[model samples]
Target: MTGRKLFKSAKFQEVNTAVKKDGAAIFVDKEGQENLIIDNPYAIRYIHSYAEDTPFFLGLADGKLRGTKCGACNYVFATPRGNCQFCGETTKWVDLPLRGKVHTWTTCHFGGEAFLKETPYNLAMIEFEGANSVLLARLKDCKEEEIYVGMPVEARFSPQPQFSITDIWFVPAGAGPGQRSKK
Candidate 1:
């Protein structure tokens, strides 16, 4: 209600009058005309099968990072893969080092629903010493200007795991939570 206006998309459905009301929304178009939008919210429990990627999520819960290694060609992946792209061979699970250097990074001005509260966050592609590829993860405890190619970083795990990628994030090598780089 300040100088800015807030607008959000909501689920629209035919509402039953017999039930307790949810609410409604007002949408303002560029023309400054207001339109009524019906809001009918419902909770859902969604299930997904990770299949071959199960090990990666499980490892995150255990405060570890899992990558895949090709036995036939010695190809290593920072991102877990079921098969090797180079040799077309089945890959085995391997542990990735906790510390890595930033290969590249970007500041996210926008993000998905799970990350909305963390808008304007930093994401980086981390390069491990032995891994052939990079892993994309959220970079915390530093501002966009402080992040650069080859910036040293270390992994931190969520104490309570949700079995999601958000369970693992990175920070400047020695930076703890709520600590920002001096740069």
Candidate 2:
């Protein structure tokens, strides 16, 4: 059976809870089964909250790109650090343009156990406008043959109704912005 189908089985979501936290509702499964945890610091830092600056997810919801700029040294950070990496000063929030270019990318044939049974997906590192750092997000709306280094792209959000929050995804802008394909 496919990983998606296996995950969709009744056994997987049996003890799931739709709990709200910090204005965002999330699905909490208590069945003691292995599942994807996207927000874990060891996995990926989804928000800038680890440092107190605005997170990229929030910026995507508001239709903007947000970053942290050092108030003391005027240094801009892409991961939105709380303090300047260079000067160790408090970082200020800054809004960035939605436009960006693909810096690097890879197609994943195998992910966690859940995705192991499914087809491959693409992940990309995108460098946004006015920022010296790159952001990592899932890439959508284009085939593998069409993706290239330095390709222009934009950020898009998919609403997760169960959680009442939006998940950010990226796609090629020239092909058509905001287009997503089913996994």
Candidate 3:
């Protein structure tokens, strides 16, 4: 599919509500009220450097896990480093399978920005197979007690306009693959 088609698919459009005049996108929960701004100009300009890892980010949006690997020393870097840590070599992006296990997680009760109204949600670190790396993201569709270290997890993408592809989140395994549970 074309880039626009891939982005306009039902799944991609699910988390978004409307695009604003400034190119910022708004996300709304089931109640139809705006929950967050995905692309506020002030925030975007400051965070745009994070977009340099677009390939890695886009892979997440496409439901795949990816990392950067050093060409010189074959070192794998997680979280899309601009350069390899081991050999100071320029890194190349590589795809990884979307299967992993939870390393750790926490429930945030307060102190996030207003955009994230869903406080007390579970945030987690997922360690994918065959890579000495972990992705910090949200754990969806599962309760706090249910999330345990070593529990299998998978990647899920949240489509927010003008945001990096790393906007991906994780949900516990057996929560029904690729399905969004009702909140």
Candidate 4:
């Protein structure tokens, strides 16, 4: 009952809130449900250093797939981990084989705004021949009925990418493993 009616904004008209002892806001809903809300959640900022995974994004920009390989255990990771999961040793960047097979797949019927435009797209867990880590990439240029557990796929880079996972997607391979180009 001590809470007062706060000023109204276009988005939040009935912005009735109470100030807590620690300077937090308690938002009361129409049904008298009280919820503590942060005043400026977006005010906090963070600076992340993706130093280890730089090569992965850089390779995508250059139309080459890259991952990290363990020097100690000889394990290759498609996610570009700085250290090996098996041996806990330092890893070295290596160009990953573009050709792989769909280890598993699913058609996404619903998604967020960015992906909603491309609704019903297929995402697949692609397994490379030499790498232990599997790359999860969007399946493109193929039909749902044609997709199989072991269907051959090749990593395709976007002509102009924004330096994220969206830069690369997988498509039906032009040829099988033995017939694919080495480079």
lDDT of each: 0.82, 0.64, 0.66, 0.77
Per-candidate TM equals 0.73, 0.63, 0.66, 0.69
- What is the model-wide C-alpha lDDT for candidate 1? 0.82
Which scores greater on TM-score, model 1 or model 3?
Answer: 1
lDDT string, candidate 1, 1-183, tens digits: 323223434222322221225354455556666555554678989788999999999999999999999999988999999999998899999999999999999999988987787788888999999999999998888888899998999998888889889889899997766553321
Give the deviation of candidate 4 from the true structure as CA RMSD: 7.8
lDDT of 3: 0.66
The lDDT leader among the candidates is 1
Cα-lDDT of candidate 4: 0.77
Instruction: Give the better candidate number (2 or 4) by TM-score.
Output: 4
Global local distance difference test of model 2? 0.64
Which tens-of-lDDT digit does each residue in 1-183 have in candidate 2?
122212223332232321111222223346645444222223555642433543655555566667788888787776677788888898888876677888999888888985687458888888876787777778877778889999998877665422212366678886665456675
Q: Model 4, range 35-56, lDDT digits (tens) per residue?
A: 6554442355667666878888
Candidate 2 positional error at 139, Å? 0.9
lDDT of 3 at 124: 83
- Name the candidate, 2 or 3, with the larger TM-score value: 3
RMSD of candidates 1 onward, in order: 8.0, 12.8, 15.3, 7.8
| Clash-forming residue pairs, model 4 | none
Ten contiguous residues minimizing lDDT sum, candidate 1? 10-19
